[model samples]
Target: MKNYVAFTGLIGAVGCFLLGPSICHATENGGTVWPLGVQTVLPAILPALGETSLYSYTAYYKADSFKDNRGDSAIPGFKLENFVQAVRIVHTWDVTFDNGVTLSSGVIGSANKIKVDAFGSSDTDSGFQELYLTPLYVGYSPSENLHLQTGFGAFVPLGNYDGSKLANSPTGNASYTQEFDLTWFPHPNWEVSVAPTFTINAKNDNTDYRSGNVFNIDYLLGYRLQSNPKVQLGLVGYYTKQVTDDHFDHGDVEDGNRLRKFAIGPQVFYAFDQTSGVALKWMKETSVRNGPKGDSLWLEFAFPL
Candidate 1:
């Protein structure tokens, strides 16, 4: 049976929205469009030929501190909470290349609710974020235990956005992303994977502020229980770094205001059947620079449709 799994890019964009409208003005951090820590299990695996599946994800993020360039608390008395829900639909075509590569396509839709308490005031907003479309995704299995994947996707601004609000919409900007991934089954019970992604941003016409490009790496180490092969326990993590400088209509912002962060935590997955499962994860952020520092909880479900 083909174990189908897909990416849910929800939290990074949702969290960026909670950071307020002025991404490069108050906090010395550049915003990003890729959701961190969302790809925890079976990241590089693809569905079987002619298979279709649906993946749903829910995430909650909370932060009480905004780190500065020096990684110190930049915003005092700052607190933020965000809830995100996203759905992904994936379909793998029956066609296979002579080189043993299969093709797939997917789309993602998301909604978010964000609340911020800062500067002795509180603000909240809730709405759809963005629409992500993956027109081209490729997968290859060189061996029974090794799988590789690559894909391209674009984000369309389909949510609400207001430059004046403290809690704005995550769909304020459109972006494009490319990703590469690999999964290794070192043993029948052990799985290890690495998925790295890069995102390029477009100018937010509302603010005329262009965020820098972001590079993120997500990794996983999991072990399936012998007693119950349906249960898997793992540690999942990610590292995010802004590679380019934030830009205005004129030029790059001073010092770039690059954002960087690292997170790691525990995750558990329970398989109800060969093609249906539920996953839960908690990620604690650390080594943050020019960004919010906090933790996030994620619940995800995957099933064949």
Candidate 2:
């Protein structure tokens, strides 16, 4: 009877959290989430995070096999693999109004490396990827257990880019993005979180080409070890889909190049304290289309200032 009651409570908690969040999805160019839930514990903890420190995180992603627009394996002639490493540093501050609204604001900057290799072909590329801003973000908490985060910013085209090359880092144009993250903790030891992003791509002046708009979602479901609350283990995943068609020549259809992909894996996170932690995650790509078909490995470290 006690077990049944606990299970019912778990289901209720999960349902409450999931209803407001999006699904998990893969991506960066394509998109992924490091997780706001992974960083906070109790509801009040949010204010502390914003007020006490700057957060620094470093993560690496390794993937192979580029999927074409149809989500099929890449065209018959080329092969692809990618190793991308990124570093992000963020600073945030919190405000709590008398009306009981808690607001947090922050900014993030990142540097990345994207390496690609192609087999059965002559295309091979590797080097400095790029540098960009993640988001100048603002977050709101309506209740102790629920937080909503949003980032309205652009990724600067400061990376290495070649208009003619398929493997370059920059899109050759600034891409605007609005990022949304919803975090919920129904129990002291468990959490459910999601991040969804909407992106608008600009025309590449160098190539006279414009890519499609993108939507990506990332998810995390976690539980802290009862014996060691700082150690968290769970499932992490993401999905990304292109909603618009790529057009060139001022909206003339060049190609309906849309993409879709899904990936999921086990993740572990351990925090030494409220100010420091490390995480490891591995995702296996599945049901992919118009994207890469392979696995990704992520190792992350978080530092709070």
Candidate 3:
């Protein structure tokens, strides 16, 4: 585990240098037009075993739309539409040593979609659509208070319209991400974490899609209601920047645009008991420059096997 962490750090640093500083500014200030959907919410429900046990697998789905204001159409139809579905199964084999240290590992999977309609057209020629399995990763928690994770994944497009479709589709680019997170509990009811993540694209189609290197900084703050262990609330926020030249798989587009996104939202979790629970979460993204933006809603139910 230690060796893997070190290797990830080295690869991230090298990717940053190779991409250069111009790539950092292209998309850094805009909202994520490509709805990655809710990656953080609805994770596997951790079992209360205090020992090794198979956690609960959860399923989730969300649909969202965004209107275009580009002013080209008398009435711009819904410019962006997205649908996402995912299933995650987690098993934690925990070992507690005499030093009070605990170790755990788990895996996750997902399927997501992003569709954009043409400005004023109703046919398939108007825009592009992509559907792909986006998550396949392993994570580890060194202690209840600290977590670290990394994974390799691929994204493939389901449909494309114009020559630019590949560049703009959500699943057009394939990449690997390395993420590390740390959480600390200062009190019985409050917990916080700082996570830094890096993404490297193995393929980029150029056009509107630029892939290279990106960095994300995430913050999570949660509080458990003093009166009920069954209820808890959390606030999550994150900022991400493209750290290298946005590389396009094709050859005609510019390579120096920056991309950045910021989001904050509330999450609620309800525990029915030791083996079951429900969750609700919501978030919105606003365009800072010339990027796609939208909002999302999610509901999930989980229970042990």
Per-structure clash totals for the candidates: 0, 14, 15
Error of 3 at 179 (Å): 1.6
What would the per-residue lDDT of candidate 2 be over residues 130-229, giving only the tens digit for each residue? 3445434555677867777666655555544554444553335566767677778889888887777777877656555556777767777889899999
Candidate with the greatest lDDT versus the true structure? 1
Give me the overall lDDT of model 1.
0.75
Better of 2 and 3 by TM-score: 2
Per-residue CA lDDT of candidate 1, range 226-245, in tens? 99999999999899988887
Cα displacement (angstroms), candidate 2, residue 290, comes to: 1.6
Question: Tens digit of lDDT per residue, candidate 3, span 213-280?
Answer: 67776566778799996787988655656677554343433445555556677878776765566667
Q: Which stretches of candidate 2 lie over 4 Å from their true place?
A: 1-64, 100-109, 117-119, 123-131, 134-136, 250-255
**Backbone clashes, candidate 1:** 0
If both were scored by lDDT, which would come out higher, candidate 1 or candidate 3? Answer: 1
lDDT of 3 at 86: 38
TM-score versus the correct structure, for each prediction: 0.92, 0.75, 0.62
